[model samples]
Target chain A: MMRQEAMGVLARANLEELRGALGAWPEPPDAESLRGPEAGLIMLRGRAGGGGAPFNLGEATVARATVRLSSGEVGFSCVLGRDLEKARLAALFDALWQREAEVVDMHLLTLVRERLAGQIERTAEETAATRVNFFTMIRGEDE
Target chain B: MYVAVKGGERAIRNAHRLLADKRRGPRNLPDITLEQIASQLALSVDRIMAEGSLYDRDLAALAMKQARGDLIEAIFLVRAYRTTAPRFGFSEPIDTSKMSIERRVSATFKDLPGGQLLGSTFDYTHRLLDPTLQGAEIEQAARADVTDEDRPMPRVTDLLAHEELIEGDGEAEEGAEVGDLTREPLSFPAERDLRLQTLARGDEGFLLGLGYSTQRGYSRTHPFVGEIRVGMVEVEIEIPELGFTVSIGEIQVTECQMVTQFQGSAKAPPQFTRGYGLVFGQGERKAMAMSLVDRALRAREFGEDVVAPAQDEEFVLSHSDNVQSTGFVEHLKLPHYVDFQAELDLVRRMRREYEDRTADEGKEAAE
Candidate 1:
């Protein structure tokens, strides 16, 4: 998978999910924080009219980190909300993915994707029931 | 002699203890967790997020819980917390067309592509409260099997734009600066961009009242709910080090596109106009109200008479923030002994002068 796809999934992965996926390696590769597991705010922007000029909507708390493996690979991850541990783990995962994409995909990336996909599917299914069952209020007025 | 009042420290401490007791609401009952407030009281969290100008649901929930469910106080808490965080770069403008929609509806069309989905709304429900819901174990909610196809839900306004029956959005120039209310104060006759930013964080009730005024013939906007969609949209920001954009997880948003009937102008032909609103959660009511006020405020742009309070940009923008309004209004409850004494002394001197003048007039009349 591409780096963009990998980072998106890693950022979304929960702490439990990341830790569970980390269990794959008998002994994890040592990673050091190159930048931050620091939490901050990312101002979110929106279009004026859904598709127009952008305006600042609000800000969301985000935690971002950069981790470099002892070898050479460096990875960066920025995720929504302020879970510093999650940010650090995501960064580590990103670095690992750069080194071994095939292994990370098998253990972590696919798991997060499948879980999120399932959630979206469940919601879409539930919402499908609510589609308006419309019939004409007046027979001639339907025209 | 000027005197200072003191010794509210003990009273203030005791008052806080009482407030804590009230927030907990009897030790016999389990306390409401922040998680529960985040999820179960989701609407309150949404309102707090919109008004607080922050998008963290967990923080919003904690604020709500701490403020004992007083939403204005909750929003204040969130705003206070927001000031401490460092600024990361703003995200790319969200594409609502790509939203993973939960609810989509339009009053303008009965049958349209991607039929209306009224996902989890209170609109049609009987207002009668169900007593069984009080501590009753809830059963399985209604669900249906859906096709795996992820169909593109085209906006109704987009279709109208194709026929040239509606005024196009007049999309902003790509490199144009969008206004930031938090960063800069608004000047008079502010552009549409700044107005939208203000409305997004403006008090929902204030917007609601203004929107209602228009319908009551204060502004007289013939509005039709062109579309209202509640869903999640991906947010992406460019990282300087990476030299590319990465998706930050999605945020749930509500967007309303209101179509208002427009009369033909001397220079332009009559076409439907648009009022838009997008808020940080399932804030349909807020979105709709915002849209109404937005259109009303756009009266000057359309060369229509700006006769309404909503149409007055200064009036709307000046008083939109509840936090600012509440702070100034509530400050009256604070000690103002010096101010009161000054006013009292002035009034006493004025009365004494009036009596002395009256006595002199009586003496002159006796002479």
Candidate 2:
């Protein structure tokens, strides 16, 4: 998979999910923290008319981290909410993926994508079930 | 007037202590957990988060609990925390078109492309309180039926715009400077961007009342609900080195599009003007009210006179922030002893002078 796609999957993964995905690895890689696993805020933006000029809607808490591996690959994580551990683990996984794409894709990206798809599928099915089946009444006849 | 009095330190300390005790209520009752507040009283948290202009669910829940369920106070707490929190950057504008909609319905069209899916709404339910819910153990929800046909959910406005039936062309100005009210102070004749930012975090009751005023013919807008969708949308941000937008995560949002009637001129045909509202969570009432106020505010854009408070941008935008309103109003609770003492002395002196003048006039009359 592409780097952006891989990063997107990693960023969306939660702390427990990211931790569970790490179990597939043989051992932790030689990674050093290049930057902090610090919590911060990101202002989420929206459009004026949902399709017009952009404006600030609100801010969401985010935790980010950057890691550099012995192999000279740099990994970064920027996920929603303030979970420093999740950011650190995701950064480490990014580094691991740069070296071993196949292994990471096989265990992590595929699973995350499938889980996301499953959620959308579930919501879509449930939403469709509640589709309104209404009967139109003639206004003058009713009157 | 500038006299500073001391000796309230001990009173203040004891007041806080009393407040803490009161917050706990009875010692026998268990403390309400943040998780419980976040889940059980979710709408309250949603309001707090939206009005506070912060989107951390857990923090909002904590604020609610700390404020003892006073939602406005909770919003104030969250707003205070937002100022101290470090800001990373702004995400790209969220696309509601590709939203994974959970609840979507249109009042204008009955059989629109996306069928009206009433996803977890309280619209049709009887308002009577369910006493059984006090200690109810709910059963598992029924499984949804599997479907292979993937129906595309298009915006109702987009459909009308295809035939040139709406005011907005539905095309955003490319490379336009996005306004951030935090970065700069909002000024007069504010564009739609700044107006949207203010309305997004504006007080629900204020907007609701203003919107209702428009309905009561204050600034009549024959409005129809084009669509209202509650769903999850992906938030993407561009990384400097990556050279591509990366999805941070999904956020639940509520969106409403209101269409109002506009008459055609001699050269132009009549078209439906649009108003938009988008909030952080499942804030349906806020969204609806915001859309109404938004359309009314567009009176000037449509060459109509701004005769109502809702149509007046300055009035709506200036007093919309409940935090600011609360600060100015609630500050009356603070000590104003010196100011009041000055008024007291002035009134006494005025009364003495008036009595002296009246006594002189009485003596002259007697003579």
Candidate 3:
């Protein structure tokens, strides 16, 4: 079996182009149609239990763009928050990310991931500070 | 408002709110601390950590608290947490030989080195409740205060090795030879690494029942607990960039080795057999049960016929994990409306065809 390291490189590269090839909102995707929440969920983390340690607060709301290739494979990319430009970029990549797309190259895909990663980092600073929540302990009868 | 069945989103949100409210039943009560669960409910946390394949006592405790004492749910929480946590590096293979033993015992010998320190076992304890624990004056036992430096532990394997009774020679299996269970789907006729990996994270109850079944005349093999060891082992990680091994942390582990009596064959010498088991934390019953099942799984090695259910590797390993079993079972409750609608349409068509065939036969007879 091929080590996981090889598979990771393939998935990341494929996903970027796959997410980018998806174009504008007017053009409906050819295959792999979906009807669900446009905004995806991203888990934001906070200090674990009020200075006790670090842990996940909960899923943060984010706008995601998804599109399917002509061959019926779907790709998805979620941004930090509701950035329409980011969502469009994600959509374009989603449309072109597949191996069969034959239009985008690996070099372009790498550039897309780097660009997306940068955009995400910038937007994350603003959104991360706002939605911090700590779950109160839920009591049971035995307690 | 002529909308047709459009309030599902609102209804789902409201239902979640109600569930949250119900989860927090009474606000007046004092909160249960993670320490309390870690100390008092240690067994449940141990099982959770074992099945979840992540050994964080505090997180396991939190999972238990969140799960409302359901160990399986706690295990699920721990598993979810495990998935999200980024993998920094791999830990060094724990040296069971150098384990700082807390509870050690052996059934193979009447006496052995390091002495069978029955140390903190519930085996001899009466089932009767101690009313003193319920009193307000409940205090930590004096024995609890004893430090690790005061008493050192020696492995039971060392004793067996000392006498040369056990087969102690096997090449160290390289890490590259082992398959990663978490990353890939398991295939049939798995290697010992994959099998042991699955059993290590398998559900306690499932393994226990399967292990028990073997004792009830299913490929019966007279087994003895050659050794049972429990203690903390330091987790080490090799840094490729740094070119050295570094200690990450420590985790409590329970290890069991069972020696089964195997009859001699024409080609091979008759000798005592071995079955190995290891689990996170102090779970003797699970470890012992695992050891028995592990041995049973090695039926092919002994040239024995695979007539028993426990001897079937697929049956034993596949069903041993509660998380996988329960998840697949419960996933049936998810939206299957599409599949159900298709089935319904097929059944209606079949009935119509059957009625038409019977009518044609009657018409032919009349003609």
Candidate 4:
């Protein structure tokens, strides 16, 4: 379950950072060669503000892939778009993480967290720029 | 009382041949190409695609040709063809907020973040027919002031949202189930998803009339068009094995957002409510009409009384398909002589009985 959560975070990480982390790993897993990548779409759902009932927002295309290692452990990765290489790499990393948790956790997991944090920060800044506040003035009759 | 009519197969075949000849129209004239229809009569193609619930421009053009330019028939042809297509998968929800806009306008606000772009609209044009367009070779004239920029435009609703004047998009729970009206039969009171799906493919004329009825005090809700945007958005599909997503293709779409005043309720404060419409191509009028109908249909959900035909979900959705309507209306041409003969017999017997009664009354009066 912990590994699965880690894999989800990894899946959502920046594409470039995920790719780079996968490259630096020693004896990179060949799990992608065993299983091909698959790409498709998933309908995105939204909720009303302040945790209201969910509604269908629209459809978003997503690519996902799963790979099984020689050991019983299976790794899965999914992300938004048709990027097959990114999906394959993420799946391979997921598989590797299960088999060699110590190395994968030390190297790939840290990078994923940093990239995610950076992304959140960037979004926050952009949204902050568009923020506006309105105030009404009191009239003489309002004494 | 009626013999069964038959042996019209040969006549039917000849009639079909004649129809083909008529559709072709004078061999000396140049045939209308699919490209011409797709490009020149783009709005028609767009309507067919939108109502047909298919997105292929080429296929829509072909259906238009096969339908002899009958838009509803073209829609039907495209819809029939769509049944044979394999379901690849549902696309990720397009972020209309990020659309590279061609045209963006709002009736509510005069000045907006994306200053109104009245791109390629007939809003200002006179309705006079141009004789010059009749069999004339069209030449492209270069405009000196054309400046193309791919800039992201902010949504007008979002601007209202900042001031807390408009209701925010309700928070959805993670992994919320969305209804697919195409696969599952539509049941009411429907979720907004199902309602939207039905309206997206509903007959534009029917929706337009319903929308107009609402405006004419049937269910008056003072609506302001928050925004009408036409643009292209990238489509991306996830590759699971690759653990990432990539762009598949882009499609042109028209999206409309309508804002209307809502009364304060115990559950929430008074705020501007929204009705949304998104269609396959540059369908501004259809989108606007769809938004109006969408708003009307939400009356029940908003705890407002449903007093109009547009507010009735079954009335609007069940009768909105032109193909179904046309089939039903045209079915009157089919022979119903046997049924009519039974009524005829009953009428004649009733008339004879009345005559006898009148004669008996006359004899009684004479005696």
Candidate 1 per-residue lDDT, tens place, A13-74, comes to 99998998888765888988899999999999988777777888889999999999998899
TM-score of chain B of 3: 0.87
Error of 3 at B215 (Å): 0.8
Isolated chain B TM-score per model? 0.94, 0.94, 0.87, 0.91
Q: Which ten residues in a row have the lowest lDDT in candidate 3 chain B?
A: B141-150
Model 2 / residue B334 / CA error / Å: 0.5
Q: Which is better, 2 or 4, measured by lDDT?
A: 2
What tens digits encode model 3's per-residue C-alpha lDDT throughout B1-367?
A: 1123344898799988887676667889777889999998898888887887776677788899888788898888878876764443344466666665566677766555554555557876888888777645765322323333323445454445555455442344433444556767889887555676777788888888878888888988888888887776544435453355443334577888877766577875566666777887889998888788878887886778898888899988888878888888887776676677788999999999999999999999999
TM-score of 4: 0.70
Please provide, for model 2 over B1-367, each residue's C-alpha lDDT reduced to its tens digit, 9 standing for 90 to 100. Answer: 3456789899899999999999999999998899999999999999999999999899999999899999999999999998898998989989998888888989889888767888888999999999999889997444467454335667787777778778763556777787878779889898888898999999999999999999999999998999999999999998887688888888999999998887699888988888899999999999999999999988877899989999999999999999999988998777789999899999999999999999999999999
Better of 3 and 4 by DockQ: 4
Calculate DockQ per candidate and list them: 0.80, 0.70, 0.01, 0.09
User: Which candidate leads the pack in lDDT?
Assistant: 1
Instruction: Candidate 1: list runs displaced more than 4 Å.
Output: A139-143, B1-7, B148-150, B357-367
Taking all chains together, each candidate's TM-score versus the true structure is 0.96, 0.95, 0.65, 0.70
Cα lDDT of model 3 by residue, A7-39, tens digit: 222223333343444432235445443422254
Tens-place lDDT digits, model 1, residues B1-367:
3346788999999999999999999899998899999989999999999999999999999999999999999999988999888997899888898888799999989888887899989999999989988889987657777764435787778877878788777778868887888888889889988999899999999999999999999989889999999999999999888888999899999999999967687877878888999999999999999999999999888888989898999999989899988888887878888988899999999999999999999999999
